[model samples]
Target: MRILFSSLVHTGHFFPLLPLAAALRDNGHELLFATGSDNHDTITSLGMTPIEAGIGLDVGAPTAAEQLGVDPDPKAERSPEELVRLIVTAFADVLPRRFVADLEPVLAERAPDLVVWEAGNLGAMIAAKRAGIPSIAHGFGRVGDDDFDVQGAEVIQRTAAEFGVELPGGRGFGDRYLDIYPESLQGKRFLAEEADLRIPLRPVPFSKPGPLPAVAEGERTRPLVYLTMGTAFGSAEVLRTAVAGLSELDVDVLVSAGPSVDAGELTGLGDRVTVESWVPQDQLLPRVDLVVHHGGAGTTLGSLGAGVPQLFLPQGADQFIHAGVVTEAGGGEQLLGEAFGADAVAETARRLLDEPGYRQVAGRIAGEIAEMPSPAEVATRVVKPG
Candidate 1:
């Protein structure tokens, strides 16, 4: 079967879909990833074929910002409701029109058997329906409390009219919904009524395989903590602050500053602290006793998979919701706004290290993750539908 996997241009949006793509490919199914041209190299690096099929909206552009009505302040805090409204109204609703235009030609050429898309890529869903192919919605992390259908109704209606297809019902498009996080971390609303269509799969973390710094080589007498701001929000200031905070602890620290932030820009680090431009979380999480990071879906699920406690300093978007879920599950802590300072980070790190309950809950979640269906198993089900 020929399957088309679609996502937005960002790595965070695309990375979560790789494990299933690998599974399908390993089973001899043909696959092509469709996204913006910006992500072509990232897809190719993972040994998957990428077809460019979306517009790269410049969020920094005055026109774009005006269209979205978003505040330019990067540090401004938004409640989950406000964030979801902004995402749906400004970004999500507008992107699908361009995605539909970009994807139409690809759909005509490939004639795929199915379309597997990230949850937010509504254009893919529209294209799949138009092409008369089944589609599946793959989630990056825990589905939040927001009602996506209600939030995205206007966009859905407009896209449907443009594509000459009927709008999806209240449940939205997709024959199946693939949720990567364990049931415990999922929003209670999603689990309560929509569990029938939601399939649970273990969140397998993947990155562009590359040579990493030799942090795992020697024996360590103290606990190891890995700090990162992820790919999108990484800044030199965040790295310096993390280093300063964690340096006060007894544990050894490794900070990944991402590609945008230069490691040399960070200074005043003690002998126990190591800073790198990029370190794959999948590779480093095993050796980490605790993780301090922006509450990205990848990091949240990856830390749980590794059985490591986490400290989430969420910036915006679904990150705040993810942090809340992690805290509720007893696998981590969420520090927001003023609480997300150097002193608070260090104090939380100390408490998490001194406490064993966090690790125990993380272990339980890890065990649950291990028992969920593997990508290979899900792939078989995808091919031979029940």
Candidate 2:
């Protein structure tokens, strides 16, 4: 099958989808990935065919920050409803017009067998519908909201609706994000069995299995701390805070700041801290003692799958809810009440390290994550739909 993949144009979002794309290609399917031009390099780097779409915000654009409504100051909190309103207006209102306008020609030209859309991309699914092709909503994280009525296709449909484009089906008529557009079937069968989608719980991105880094083997001698704030939210201050928290501990700290944060700003980092642009969390999780993160769905669940103790310091988005899920599941602790600082972070890190309940709960969550289908497995089923 020829697949058209559309998603949010950020490295973190695209990175997870790479494994699935590779799997489809290996299985003899043709894949074309579409996102903002900003992510072109990342798309090509992953060895996927790239379709350029002018539908993303510039990561370095000052206006982009204003558009996102993220206050750089950690102390200032946007009311949850206000934040929701901001995000809803941004993606559901502002983004669709631009996205749909750009996607029309691409849809007409590609005419793919199926559109594999990131649940957060807004209007590509609508374009797929416009092209009269079967489309699948692929979520890289938890699916929230019931609008547009299709399961998990929040970004796509909402963006389309904003542009006054009617979808082929009614609302509540397709798969939810987690289910990958199950509601849209109307009895149409899928290549991957629906039952298989349910078996592993959720899709996880991973590279082909390989040996761990040489340093990783010996690094396990002490408690291993995997510290990251995800690809989007990393900052010098956050890195400094993470480094400070782990400074006094006997643990080996691994920090991934993505390409966003400055390396020079991490000057005072402790000797045990290893900072990098990226690391293989799936590969490193088993050897780590605890995972401290900004509560992005990808990292939160990634850590959970490893069954490692988690300390979530959510800064935005659905992270708050994901943190709540982890806390409710008894998997780890939620660091609340303040923007993180070295002292507070250190204390939280200590709790995650020393608390027996935290470890036990994390172990259970890991078991749950492990049971989810790998991303490749999910894609195999989705592509080969019966």
Candidate 2 minimal-lDDT segment of 10 residues: 180-189
> Which residues of candidate 2, in runs, are more than 4 Å off?
45-47, 59-79, 145-164, 167-202, 206-215, 384-386
List model 1 lDDT by residue over 5-86, tens digit each: 9998776788899999999988888889998887788778766788988754344222334566766454556666655565
Instruction: Evaluate model 2: give its TM-score.
Output: 0.80
Give the deviation of candidate 2 from the true structure as CA RMSD.
5.8
lDDT of each: 0.79, 0.64
Q: Give a tens-digit lDDT track for model 2, residues 33-141.
A: 8887776776676667788764554432223236665663434567755445455555554554555677789878877887876666656766666667777666565
Model 2 has how many clashing residue pairs?
A: 21
Candidates in order, TM-scores: namely 0.92, 0.80
Off by over 4 Å in 1: 56-64, 68-84, 147-149, 170-174
Q: What is the TM-score of candidate 1?
A: 0.92
